[model samples]
Target: MFRPAASIAGLITPSPYTQFARAAYCHGTNTWSCEEACAANSDFRVYVTGGDDSDTPDFFVGYWPTGNAAIVAHEGTDPLQLLSLNSAIQAHTGFLGAHSRSAGVVLSAVQKVISEHNVTEVITVGHSLGMLHTIAGC
Candidate 1:
């Protein structure tokens, strides 16, 4: 179960980056690698997480190479702006298990990133439970 705050509407707009997934196979396992995506597309790279339920948080920043050049997730817990993934994950909430604190921490970290990087524009995106999380962060 997830609930989104109305503040989300002021954060970001729905875009293609909402569905972008950056992953790679390693040790016979699939890994959603944010660093790899950042390295590949630094200008439009971002991060994601799982929502309260099974739905994972989509993007919180620039779009993927194949998607539009718009920001998807503009909430405080944006994964793209943060320098530390662990810290971002620790800020999240509204979830069970390991991802509970992800939203909060990610939001804080992204705020820092925006300030540090001087990012003026961004987008927020999510689906199902993730959408709620995105809204709350905004």
Candidate 2:
């Protein structure tokens, strides 16, 4: 989510990017609502949004100008995806869906934001279940 540089920012006494990760699981997220839920970073402009059903990964990317960083936020295991991931693990395939989802998409988005905005930092945040996908870039 890319918020304009002029947007007001909040005081984050905790991990500076905590709210970004939590935005996807916002209470009203079932309806795809997160703007107000992420009021602290309300200025963020959602650049990319994807995922819902079992086979896909749920994630959002946006830029926070105030922080001079691009933010990638991902939802934890959606109950449906969780089951599928577990099945893959049990099958010994070691396929975690990262290839089909993050490798290209995430790298492309991050690169775009970095080059276009010349952002000084790139931060990726998410709950434990989804954090594994972050390693896809490796």
Candidate 3:
């Protein structure tokens, strides 16, 4: 169900990182495509990419975007302020006595792909706050 980052990135237009993620990962799919089958049903999206076997270590790339949210189910996850390093760190560490919810979803998607696809490695790609989440997940 992976759609190659280039195809689904438009769901969030003007995101320069989308292009970067696509190029770096070379393969990915939107949340909707990976949702049911991949077990990523979170309101927020954690694009999953991994289907090529030409590479030495077959792996998956989990992509997270900064400042994009459609669900406010988690407390303290403000779309407007997610750009701040503090907020991104807090979200990654689950500072609100709980995570921003999307954090779990994103992590879950990463795990799902790794486990389901027998991935040997995982590359997390993003910009700004996304970089924080990516490092934190590792």
Candidate 4:
């Protein structure tokens, strides 16, 4: 008897990229490769990530060409933005806004993208410092 492929599909998450989009989006040349992959998959060209030179932390969001929602992920503190580490230290129980200014940049972009693309759902992914920003922003 043959079992349906779907029986084992649950163990795997379908992803076209060889690595997580977060890693590709965070790096330099890999970012370009990830963009190419996205382009090939669909006309979906929309992409936003934490600024390389800006004070904001690392954040990434991408949408499928035909999908109405998207998933955003954050990477570790960008080496260029060491101040992010300071902000993280200041993010104590009563000081959530220590980095609100920087976070605003990413938050604003996220809002704009969602509204512009009519995205209805947003799933977030992150690790370490990135995780902190995601939790604080949302």
Candidate 5:
């Protein structure tokens, strides 16, 4: 799946900061701990991060000062999460009760951070299952 850089030279690639943010997104898929990943990205400044693996889905909201927007980072799936551990779950448009609430929390957090920072817009990123929410406009 690896494409040579030379072959992709004509294609527009992600910026340095975009790549950094993706790293944080990937980490969210596996861990709720955003500190290390978010902190390591110099282009982003960690504003606030909170999530619970037991019920709530994990999210990271940070200010992308350079990009003049807030970045909402979410994960796809974390094996440690209770909902993910459940075997009876099935993929559907209607997420479980816990997932619904978690989505609400993530939305509110993104709104609060963007308003507080007065960012022009938000750049959302996710890895794995996280992409589903993003695509669903959640």
Candidate 6:
């Protein structure tokens, strides 16, 4: 499982670099927070993302490379998130389907990173509404 930077110590120290990384990931949104993590500590690079079924625009994606331990974060409020949530709602009851859809998107992004970077392992981290995204990344 991937651990969110907020949960881990030393993974994200208080610094300007961490702030910059978080800002990038949030896409200037005030809703989410970001911190530095040990992406390079392991032999793989991990990507994470999050979304809410109720809203289409609160989605985010993050990337961390094991080699450099760098974090890249992306977020947007778009129809893509809505479509994913809609698909989930149509297939199942409650929020399970929505979560599944969000996870799928996150996983898809992770796969791309793996293929591009030749990553061997992948870790995902999401908090609150982003938990589904994290699971999907895995």
What is the per-residue lDDT of model 2 for residues 12-110, given as tens digits with 9 covering 90 to 100? Answer: 343347777777565443333666457767656666767653455577777777788888776666565344544435621333664366556767878
Clashes in model 3: which pairs?
none
RMSD of 5: 6.4
TM-score of each: 0.39, 0.68, 0.34, 0.53, 0.58, 0.42
User: Could you tell me the TM-score of candidate 5?
Assistant: 0.58
Clash totals for all candidate models: 22, 8, 0, 0, 2, 3
Indicate which candidate wins on TM-score: 2
**Candidate 5 residue runs with Cα over 4 Å from true position:** 1-36, 78-89
lDDT order, best first, reads 2, 5, 4, 6, 1, 3
Once model 4 is optimally superposed onto the true structure by TM-score, how far is the C-alpha of residue 115 displaced, in angstroms? 2.1
What's the lDDT for candidate 4?
Answer: 0.51
Q: Which residue pairs collide, candidate 2?
A: 1-61, 1-62, 1-63, 2-45, 2-63, 3-43, 3-44, 3-45
Write the number of the candidate with greater lDDT, choosing between 1 and 6: 6
What is candidate 1's TM-score against the reference?
0.39
The lDDT per prediction is: 0.40, 0.63, 0.37, 0.51, 0.57, 0.41
Model 1, position 54: C-alpha lDDT score: 24
Q: Which should have the higher lDDT, number 1 or number 3?
A: 1
What does candidate 3 score on TM?
0.34
Candidate 5 structure quality by residue, lDDT tens digits, 1-138: 133355564356654334544554344423334454544555666655555644544556666777777777655565454455567877564345445755665677668777888887777766656555544554
For model 3, residues 1-138, the per-residue Cα lDDT tens digits are 123546565665533334433333222343334323223322334444332222111123443233232111111123564466564353323332222434556566656655555555444444443344445434
Give the top-scoring candidate (lDDT): 2
